[model samples]
Target: MTPPELDRKSALFLDLDGTLLEIAATPEQVVVPPGLPSLLAHLHHQLEGAVAIVTGRPLAQTDELLRPFSASAAGEHGVSLRYADGTREELPAGIAVPSAWREELEAAVQRWPGVLVEPKPHGFAVHYRLAPEYGNEVWRLVRQLVPPEHPWFHLVPAREAVEIGLRSASKGHAVERLMAHAPFHGRRPIFIGDDFTDEAGMRKARELGGIGLRVAEVFGGDPANVRAWLMEGAQRLDGRSASSIPTGVTP
Candidate 1:
């Protein structure tokens, strides 16, 4: 679908991995471009603080990377949230992966060699991005651990990874929660993401009278393009045409 023209009333919900940032072999290996922080901050300012990041990574990790911005965000697939005010919330009852499950996954990694076991506050993810050959094994093992129709947890599939997160927690719920708060409420939502897990958020955006843009169709699956698109929106909102982008956006 064609992307809508961004406007003053638009509230933005963005996904980090594979959308704003290039997909990396491992989560830790992902590098934040030098100008991303400032660009996001400027966009946040332009939107009157209506911009929020909805990512699978934990809020602490998001903060560590974005530093001073500390924009409102949903983390751990929406199990955790940090509002625009710096207050945080964990929607689940401190739910964590079972010891047996972690041990089993860790053991499987030894056999898989390049597969990595990622631990989260709410659950865990098995990433086979580094070892694409083990993708089937990783997916099979995750399904075996938390099968479909499991009452408490569900599988969230990303590029080459699968996470076992609470079924009750989702990007859709996260978007709703964030939109209900100040600066975001009473505005149109524009959600952009690039994975199966992001579908929920995109769907919710459409339901809420906004647009959901897929990275592949809209920007040719390039993070640089996403950033440039956002900058264009900000410039347009700032009353500057695409041809007259001035020096830079201040953080």
Candidate 2:
């Protein structure tokens, strides 16, 4: 079920970009909202340790953004998690894409004036925010490089890019695993995100009896507006936006 209709004993699953931090031209340009860590800490206390960030980012990156709060963080779309006990676990590695295919896609991206590729252990992201008009062309080429029927790899859409990754892993799997684990168990699931990649986590939360709160739009908007939108979304989930939760999006 959606938020407001969720049962009291639910968990909180949040997204990072567009949801917590404002989105940027490049992935690296995104800024973590100030004071989010403190807000997360308070929310954790309020929830009794039932909250966590479930995102598509890598685990280390997620931790860096939420360092101030130092709470549990998940990365690689839930393929990894840093628990409240300070333990780390990397979920199963995803299907390996052929190196030749990756190279071919990267080389082809160079022809696109404003697109850039983001490399991941099991996936790649083609970003086109700098030139939105090139998106369709970039997508067409990327799709050609990785066919839809490919068994091990698939193309997943994000806000400003398309991601190619192992089909076996996803944010949904992470939510399932986290829900079955300690501190996060028995609580209702609540997920927040702002991209198409986050849809899996949102669906998982709904299936598990929780809610997904999608962050406001962030692309091509004023920085101040983006920040305000992010803060507003956070406030809905935690009752306060900036200083209410240990922040980061991962897994």
Give candidates' CA RMSD values in order. Answer: 2.0, 5.1
| Alpha-carbon local distance difference test for all models | 0.86, 0.70
Model 2 weakest 10-residue run by lDDT: 217-226
How do the residues 1-251 of candidate 1 rate in per-residue lDDT, one tens digit apiece?
56777788999999998888999989999988877887788788888899999999988898888777778899988999888898888887766778899899999899998899889888888898889999998888888989788888888888888888899999999998888888888899999999988899999888888888999999999988898888878787888765454344421
- The top-ranked prediction according to lDDT is 1
Q: TM-score for model 2?
A: 0.79
* lDDT, candidate 2, 165-223, per-residue tens: 76767788878877888788877787777778788888888888776665543224233
Where is model 1 more than 4 Å wrong at Cα?
Answer: 241-251
Clashing pairs in 1: none
